[model samples]
Target: MTAIYSIFGRISETIEKLAAIHRLLPWILAFALLLPLPQILSALFNDYYIYLANKICIFILLSVGLNIVKGFCGQVTVGHVGLYAIGAVSSALISLHFGWSFWLAFPIGILAAGLAGIVVGLPSVRLEGAYLALATLGLGESVRIMIAVTPLFGSSTGLLSIPAPTIGSFTFDSYTNYYYLVLAAAMIGIYLSFSILRSATGRAFMAVREDTVAAAVHGVNVTKYKLLAFVISALYAGAAGGLFAHMPPGYIHHNNFTIIEMVTLLLMIVLGGIGHIWGGIIGAIIVTIIYDQTLEFYFYQPLLFGLTMVLIVIFMPRGIGGMIDRYLATKKFIASQEEKSNAAS
Candidate 1:
């Protein structure tokens, strides 16, 4: 454990030094390095792995956004899937009905979800704890029910044949081709998440999360920050939805957004470590892979997921990311002690 922490500490220091050269330098290099991921996945495993990668990327976006509200702002929202549904359905409908390109429809879908986020967040002003959870859950379930019953929203049929993005003659209509589009979005989403977490807005959110009354006392405008967290989180969900809707095969059903799905998302953040910066990213990758691998045990999947969440809460309440954070903090403190001892000598 100490060795692992040392390795991570060294790597983190390297990254900080690189970041110091230019704020975006590390991210730019990361983007460039990730550009060939699709080809590499295809080479090592198979084309199906590329599809899984795309799914993971989308989940990354969703989980990260969910973290902003549920983790950062300490708002218990289960209706994030509803915002996701709005984005996917909105984008799909625009492409199917108005014949808009993915480029245009994507942002529109995101906008629609962002608007819905305000509605979902409204209850937070007066609610807390389980009551807030129930309100968000109700709102989320209502969206799924509306989609399931309404023929215009595709109902049981679902929306299909959503167009892929294109750049002139180049069409991102294949899994390999579509990987770049989603990968870029996921990367940008992560970068922005980190940016938000480090900004004054993020501190205000943390203040609100840590203590709503205290935040208000400090002139934090707790209500506004709470709402802003949801809005920002919704934007990420919306972007994820748009991408998922337009992915190859381009079909979206009401079943895609459900209580089970919301639970899975919650598991991601919980397993990764809620409020930790890399929690969503780690949880998304691990859970997505685990879920994909356990597809054959469909009957037991939910049970397995539920059991895993419970176990994690009991044994590792802080999660893998939290453990890592502790290790890093410990390593830093030890180094400082050594430095002081040497100076005393």
Candidate 2:
């Protein structure tokens, strides 16, 4: 019995170590690819691989954006899909109607999403907990209905024939080009978000999240920061929306903004760990890959998703990112203790 327990403990330690490596691996590879490594690899691979790479990059962007609001800002929003829809439609309308290029449409669409976020978020200053969630719940349905009614938004049929993004003279018609485009945008967003969080504004936002009243007493300007958080998050969703609409398929529908879509985004944020940027990214990737692959294999993907979600929430409330952070902190503490003891000797 003792031997069996020891073996199990060893296996668990080994698995945890591997998981840590896996989490850090993506960032390392991303950095490496930005160096001479990508050139070496591209020398061997073809364009098809780039296509799938583009998909993953786009998902990473979407997750990272959603994380800005839900994870970092501590916003319990369930209407992210609606924000995404607003962004997608906004850009689609401009590009479709006026032939506005990516340079113009992308920023415009993001601003539109921000405006929508403010429109919805500005009214929710007093509502917290379930009330905020409930109010945002109405937003998704309301926008969904509006899209259903207006022929300009494609009525119930939704928008079709959305144009691909073109930057200057270059048309983003190929997956490889679009992949680089999306990757660049995602990298910009990730850098800006991390940079913002390290700034006074980000600190104020975090303070507001922890305790609004306490933040106010500290002169953090809670209302201003909170609105900033919402707008930043909406900007992310809007950019992602434009990417989704401009991708290979080059079409979108209101069904893409369904309630489940919003729920899934929130689930990714919660399951990965709230108030953590990387958490949202991992959660999004995990959920997207699992649900996408599972649906391909069978139709009962929801059952598996629900089960996974429940198990994660029940057993690891802080989520995968939280667990990783704890582990890292512990490791560093132990190393510091070891150094201190060695110095004393």
Candidate 3:
């Protein structure tokens, strides 16, 4: 703890200085989020594509959520799909069985999922890296089995006929309306993530991620903050699952937890950048687009994912995000050198 505190104590002034300048950037991000894609949503049948687009937005939100725990906090949680399932089941059961409205249930579902994350976080907090990963994988599997074995969850039959979110009388029935709702949700997730990374907690997460022992010495409550990250990640996941449950053109069969799916999410974060949100964004888009476009050509889907992951890892230790950071570092270094030369001359 002293080490982290000492390092931060030394650099605290600089960090605060940077934060002052960077805080307003969130508004710019808000604007950027609102800007519509000019070329893509142009077709009359683009509604179908918009449907695809909404799915991407959902995945992006999920990826961002996963990034908080797995990427930034240096924790490995393979139980995210379990979190998803929890949220969906919470909301769906309330709506389908109890006759509660979707509106009342959505937020409740998110809270329930948050509680689940905290529960999952408790045991995992004592663990780190591979051990923790395996624990979460086990948890996910357990959750899957519980859902499949229980009649309430419809076992293998699975739950169907979800209600949709609405504002008063206007049903979010159209693809465009649904797109906006999911997009707004996705944007909110991105914004929160950005804010988090810039804040003091984020720096602590990075410190722990880089070296837990060292980070602890610097006064980071490693356990607490790691738990916080897990909760934040799961919060996003729950919101996504809730939205997925309520939104139309809905999922017929909920995805069961698999080692492969967990590995795929890890691949997404690793390929994007461990702590970088943009990495998840990029990874999710690439993975989802390929998966959607190539399902008919089933032979190459897994092969392409494998090839993409292997090639990126070989060439890039930091993945795509790492390379971008390196480039920025190099550019700054060269610029500083040029300035020094200019001053000397």
Candidate 2 Cα misplacement greater than 4 A, ranges: 1-52
lDDT of 2: 0.73
Kindly list the per-residue Cα lDDT of model 1 for residues 1-345, writing each as its tens digit: 778777767878887998999988888888898888889988999999999999999999999999999889999999999999999999999999999888899999999999999999999999998999999999999999999999988999998788898989999999999988998899899999999999999999999999998999999998899999999999999999999999999999999999999999999999999997687888999999999999999999989999999999999898878988998888789989999999999
The per-residue C-alpha lDDT of model 2 at residue 140 equals: 63
Best by TM-score: 1
Q: Show how many residue pairs clash in every candidate, following the order shown.
A: 0, 1, 11
What's the distance in Å from true for residue 129, model 2?
A: 1.0
The alpha-carbon deviation from the true structure for residue 232 of candidate 1, after best TM-score superposition, in angstroms, is 0.6
Best by lDDT: 1
Residue pairs of candidate 1 with colliding backbone atoms: none
Q: Which ten residues in a row have the lowest lDDT in candidate 3?
A: 4-13
TM-score of 1: 0.98
| Alpha-carbon lDDT, every model | 0.92, 0.73, 0.76
- Which residue runs of candidate 3 sit more than 4 Å off their true CA positions? 1-45
Local error of candidate 3 at residue 281 (angstroms): 0.8
- Descending-TM-score candidate ranking: 1, 3, 2
Q: What TM-score does structure 2 among the candidates reach?
A: 0.85
